[model samples]
Target chain A: MVSKTEETQLNRLENQVDNGGGGAWEYLCLVRKLKVRRSEKVLKHGLSILNDPKKRSALGPEEWTLYEQVAIAAMDCQCLDVAKDCIKVLQKKFPESKRVGRLEGMLLEAKGSWAEAEKAYSSLLEDNPLDQVIQKRRVAMAKAQGNISGAIECLNKYLEIFMADHDAWRELAEIYVSLQMYKQAAFCYEELILSQPTVPLYHLAYADVLYTLGGLENLQTAKKYYASTIDLTGGKNTRALLGICLCTSAIAQLSKGRNKEDKESPELQSLAATALEKDYKQRASDKLGLLTSALRSLKI
Target chain B: MGLGFIIGVFGVLILSHAAYSTIQYRGLLKIMEEEFSGPPMNVVLELLLGFVFCIWAALTVPGKFLSIHPDSEENRIVSLSANLDFMIFNHRAKAFPLEIDMKLKH
Candidate 1:
């Protein structure tokens, strides 16, 4: 029932493989097509092409394409057991392959076997310590298990590998915030703000952390963060809320500084810093209040 | 009472839907491999069937009774409607509410 053109195309694909033109991806695609067509002949041919040691030598890398193909085929056939077996075989053979390892993790995770999957991912890390996907999954599993320390460790490990990953940094900051590790969380948020200066939420979160930590010395930085956040968000009230925080921090710092210095206090520095912080806070609060009133009016 | 009943119905559906979809998703994967040429259509059909299965599962299985938990930011315990609650928790939850606490973080 196949059209001549289709047959010719399949033949061309075979020729491409024969001539060393087919890469790993091309072979995988052929195997997938074989599965789609339910052509065992084609599937076998595709496998042979993938398994050919000569092809592997030419292709430069032989990872988990064949294993993935078999797993997909097995899953398509409703052979969960076979799919499971294929996964095991793939895991054993291509232990370092990302796709195979991830699929194995997903299958275990799907079965509600979180502990086993976590263990597997941990073992996987022993081999590929810098695998971001494995690290992220480990964090996710740890978080799911409510192991905050474990999740933090996993995320930290991931951060070590991918220092510039803003999302990872933000997530780590969020986790630290939730854990009430205010100082650590503040630093993370600050780093994120430094990298993605345009994002208002990072500043807001950082300011919140500074307020929670209850240090007035950080008020100046908090104010800058809140101001920047507000500007980026079109001067929204989120900025204002954060601004109040900055005000409080400044007051706390000035009062503490005054008491610490006693008669020797730098009165000029204290007054200038406090006045600057108070002004910023008041402006933010007023704008935020206006937004709140507008929101209330809209609701009504 | 209406809220409780609606909640009960909703709980049942959520459980059934998850189970049914899992089964159908597995089934569709097999079908896709067996007949690869028209897999897109089959994939769509499987998704549609998955939706239907979810609805059916919601209607039949009393999800509230099972110790089912979803790991998400919002930890929603299985709060069943009064009617479904009667059927599911009457025996086990005589002294306490049939609530499954999902610990999102340790």
Candidate 2:
């Protein structure tokens, strides 16, 4: 999801910090903003600033946020000691802070103390039942501890309160997909598509689920969604093109000779195939044979 | 990144330098007891060169303008409001108890 400019800026900042160019804080903030998984880089560069007292103070009030950032990145990196020390600094500075208490719960989670983490999250939830972050954390904890059903239940309950959360819906849809529950996954994808009709990812995912469900009506609907995905992505997504091909061929086979004019629109398959060929020709002409062979196997 | 960004900044610096040169020229004219005319020719040329550099850099920075377009699908607001604070990377779904699947199926 990161833009090219932002990605290049992140690389430049990382190099600048690595060479002691003194922008460790800026690099860490960009990393956070992008939500990138650069735990090692963040931990290394962040500790350099944290270990230096002068550099830490130079950030002023932002230093506390930097400490929290480093703490989370450290936890991701499995550096419990550094995370503990950072949390201790935060706790000492802001005693009775619910934010710091959340950090404590996350730390317990990182240490694999499931019961303690649950207890901590429960207490936090007790203080504020509408603590959405804490509730999500509880679900994530359940998922992390291999309690898939519990995670699903918790996510359902969480969605009851936060129905507008597309991310949670996506997470639930993904969990259902992994469990081979295409119907449930399709429900979640429908919810997501209803909320965000412009998002091609949701459309593509819904099409995938619908195609996997596999029936006359579902395959037709899946092909429609796949075409919508292609329109949304400007015909750049090979997966959606392939989906259109697959759905077309499947629908054709299922409805073979059933009617004189079944409205199958045989031209749709050739159009999809042409688009696929054009894409392959422009990008990887060397592997065009593989693509043609694969398409031939699909009978489209 | 360094090339385009540096060229842009250099153009900005040059434009500022041109402004400064104009001011210096005015001061020199006042000291010489002459009329306060326009900037020197070299400063005008420098301004044009800087403007061209800025335009070039603007058109070809780290990426193309379509990526930043408001209507492009790639620029869509997909996960801007994602509640990632609760995100956990270490998923153990594969290790989930098989009995639970049997229970869920029914």
Candidate 3:
């Protein structure tokens, strides 16, 4: 993660490149390396280079990669003609590339010609059924056509083959959440947590799902996960702090008629509240009063 | 450059000076035809000081190693995932008049 200073520097470079300044090639490389989405700017700047004979040739062997990048970016920006043009160049350059073939299938999918796209993808898959990207495209195509169940089924199949893929798990979990299938979503999150326990996003998402389930046991588990999220993020995440307070309040409400020993502790809530207040004081002093009143309403 | 960098540079200069002084002292001893005693204590001190300064500079120049996956405001993960291969924000329906229907039962 870039600090504020580095982030500003990147923004400045983006603006300069956007205005047709130099470093367009360098900026595009940076975007790809960092996996940041800058499709509109990439389409514009990438076309500028591709459309120029001298500048395009100056890239030498890197020219084909630039073509692929522009093609993908153009597809994103709804410039099908530009995408077709770039893909045509790539196809001419490498006639038998499976990668280029995948691009063709993608272009057809983008054009909404489902039958032709299905045939293209099927033929490509026959060559290499282990292609992860093609399988994901199938799920994406199902989703694009508003077939959520089909998408989920495709994703589950993909997971059976590639269980280690975090993105597929995340997508499946999100689809299950949308369907309000909390148990399935929780299982997906469990898979995610098992795969990469350090990623705070999955922890936070799992906590949210458990909280939504809202049973006595689920709430207790949700509180633990939320605390783990806070620990993973070094206590800077405000939502996790609020989750602690909320879980404590709910536990208190549920435990009123229970034995004293069965009641959950509350000191963790007070500590979370203090940390939240300190964070607010440091970042938004004027909103401290509001935060105090909100915490007071939570009755901790 | 900060003070540590200046000290590093200074340390390099001193190391070079120590090497030069050793060369010059050897030349002098050969000219005077005297037995080469251990050259001078000052050269060893200069080498030690330069070593310390260079180490300090090496540690100070680049600063600390930060966590690249921070989810704070400065470096929040804007996109859910890269998921570039599956991005379906726009399609032929928006770009041009549709010739075929995608919503047809498959």
- Name the candidate that leads on DockQ: 3
lDDT at position A246, candidate 2: 95
For B14-91, candidate 1 gives per-residue lDDT tens digits of: 556656766666678788766433334544565566566556555555545432222111222111111110011112
lDDT of each: 0.55, 0.82, 0.81
Q: How do all models score by TM-score?
A: 0.40, 0.72, 0.76
Fnat for each model: 0.00, 0.11, 0.22
DockQ of each: 0.01, 0.06, 0.14
Q: Choose the strongest candidate by TM-score.
A: 3
Listed per candidate, the RMSD to the true structure in angstroms reads 27.8, 10.4, 6.7
Residue pairs clashing in model 2 are none
Q: For all the models shown, what interface RMSD does each have?
A: 23.0, 13.0, 9.2
True contacts kept of 1: 0.00
lDDT of 2 by residue, A106-211 (tens): 9999888899999999999899989988888998999888899999999999999899988789889989999999999999999999998877778989999999
Q: Residue A7 deviation, candidate 1, in Å? A: 46
In Å, residue A56's CA in model 3 sits off its true spot by 2.5
Docking class of predicted structure 2: incorrect
| Deviating ranges (above 4 Å) for candidate 3 | A1-12, A19-22, A260-265, A281-290, B1-80, B90-106
Residue A149, candidate 3: Cα error in Å is 1.5
lDDT of 3 by residue, A1-300 (tens): 233444566688898986867998888887776656787777877887887888888999999999899888777766778888889889999999988998888888777798898899999899899999999988988888889999999999998999898888888898899999999999999999998776777888999999999988899999999998887677878888999899888877777687768545657899999999999999999999999998899883
